[model samples]
Target: MISETMESHKKDSPSDIKCGIITLSDSLKEKGNEGIEEDLSGQYLFERLSEKYEVSAYVLIADESDKLIQAISNMNSKGIDVIFTTGGTGLESRDITIETLVPRFDKVILGFGEEFRRKSFEKLGSGALLSRSTAGIYNKTIIFALPGSPNAVEMGLNLIYPEIGHLVKHARK
Candidate 1:
């Protein structure tokens, strides 16, 4: 089933999907006027997404629910095809990315989290179970919320980017 689906998607998925990236980390967000430090995960997202899709926006915001929610709204309003967010998917008190976005999901892609953990386990042992990475559709935009670590982001990117257009195609239908 999986192989046949992949073969089918190879020819018909939308190719012009636009993307927006968000990095959610208190430490990475700038305090007041101070310049924010580099966000490696967001950088990696840009470098990779730009290679195939038109990147429409990128923002680094603290792990605050209100702010993150607003960012998602803004991105979706901009007609973005997808939003890839990194960080705030853990047990910490400030980790609210998943909490904020889940309720807004028009359709939750349950397999993403399971597949992420399965893939992560191959590299991170049993610790991968604690990660809450997920993807979902919000209105017309698809959002992929990944962990903050660079390695985790890389794994999530590899697993999702290839199917982004396929995901978008179905969301539109």
Candidate 2:
């Protein structure tokens, strides 16, 4: 039933979606964009995403709300179809990505976080629950907040990449 229900909405759409990569890490932001060397997870996201989608913007910002808002605005200005934020979704006090972005979401994609945890749980045991990764529609763009670690980013990217274009089509409305 669910598969058929989902299949009903599976209409044809172009896949030339543009993307933006944002790294929310206070430590890396201290070095500015020059800190790209230390941003392994973000770099990985950029490289992988760039293969199928155009990476319009890649930025490193502190876990501050102002910085996050600004980055999203810049991405929106470029008409980015989706924004992927890595880091600041863990249990640390500086993990403000999800908290700062959630209130602004026009529609939260709840299944993203839930499924991410479920998938992570298989590999990480109970520690997977500590991740607060989330996804949503904001400013007509799809934003996915993922964890900071390289492994987590890899998993999150793999989980979402195939559906990104499909997800963007709905959010574009």
Candidate 3:
């Protein structure tokens, strides 16, 4: 019965969902940091999401709360279906992604954070507890806050991509 419901949702879901990728990192925003290479997490997300969804915007910003909030708001106004925010999801003082976005959420997807930590614990042992990755809906836009590491980004995206269509469909309705 559950499978039937899922199949029905999949059939009704839109195929051209638009996604926005934001990488929040103080170092990445530095102008003279020559050693700082490309944003691997954002690139990975773009490549993977582009395979199934439309990537409408991509940007790298500092770890400031105002900047993050503004970016999210701008994307929401642009009618983006989903937004993937990479970086600043850890326990460090500068890791403020979750803190910045939580208040903006209309409905928090608590299961996403729980399952993310559970799966992350399997691969990263106890260190996973330090990660505060989460997902939620804000003004009809689904937002996923992920850790800075490429591995974490891959894991989080892998877990959510399968259900993103359904989530978006429901959120829009």
Candidate 4:
């Protein structure tokens, strides 16, 4: 649950967005004692969005297809306005986040991947092309799949957050 202070601050605010953050990684979820060493770009973005929009939840899970599907489905069922998933958008064999999410989306936001790669290419050159970043609507929730790296997460959030409020509002309608 989001804090009351956060909720009250967002109520009647211009940005009526509500968001959930999900981090996907294989080692992070397993390995019992190993901590998630990578910085969470989604968490940083969520904090900034919280200034005007409610943040409903933040979750971290493994790279398994089943886990990703289940977590995404669960979040959608919770009626979250938007969901940001960081990591597992690479070409690696274990990177099945996109596969698991494709069947669940109501519509694919193809431009998201195009824009994300375009922006990332400015920083990472040809490496950006390897990213499969994407976004779509699912059960009225706007779901965005971001690259695993913190820098990629930053790029995705910077581009997407501005319009998420409006997108969510429209999706609900």
Which candidate ranks first by TM-score, i.e. highest?
3
Better of 1 and 3 by lDDT: 3
After superposition, the stretches of candidate 4 with alpha carbons farther than 4 Å from their true spots are 1-14, 31-39
Q: State TM-scores per candidate.
A: 0.93, 0.93, 0.94, 0.83
Better of 1 and 4 by lDDT: 1
TM-score of 3: 0.94
Relative to the true structure, how large is the alpha-carbon lDDT of every model? 0.88, 0.89, 0.90, 0.77
| Candidate closer to the true structure by TM-score (higher is better), 1 or 3 | 3
Best by lDDT: 3
Query: Residue 31: error of model 4 in Å?
Result: 5.4
Q: Write the per-residue lDDT of candidate 2 for residues 11-68, one digit (tens) a residue.
A: 5544889999999888888897678888999999989998888999999988888899
* Per-residue lDDT of candidate 3, residues 49-90 (tens digit): 999999999888999999999898898899999999999988
Tell me the tens digit of each residue's lDDT in model 4 across 41-69.
65676677687778787777888887777
Q: Which is the winner by TM-score between candidate 3 and candidate 4?
A: 3
Clashes of each: 0, 0, 0, 1
Worst ten in a row by lDDT for model 3: 28-37
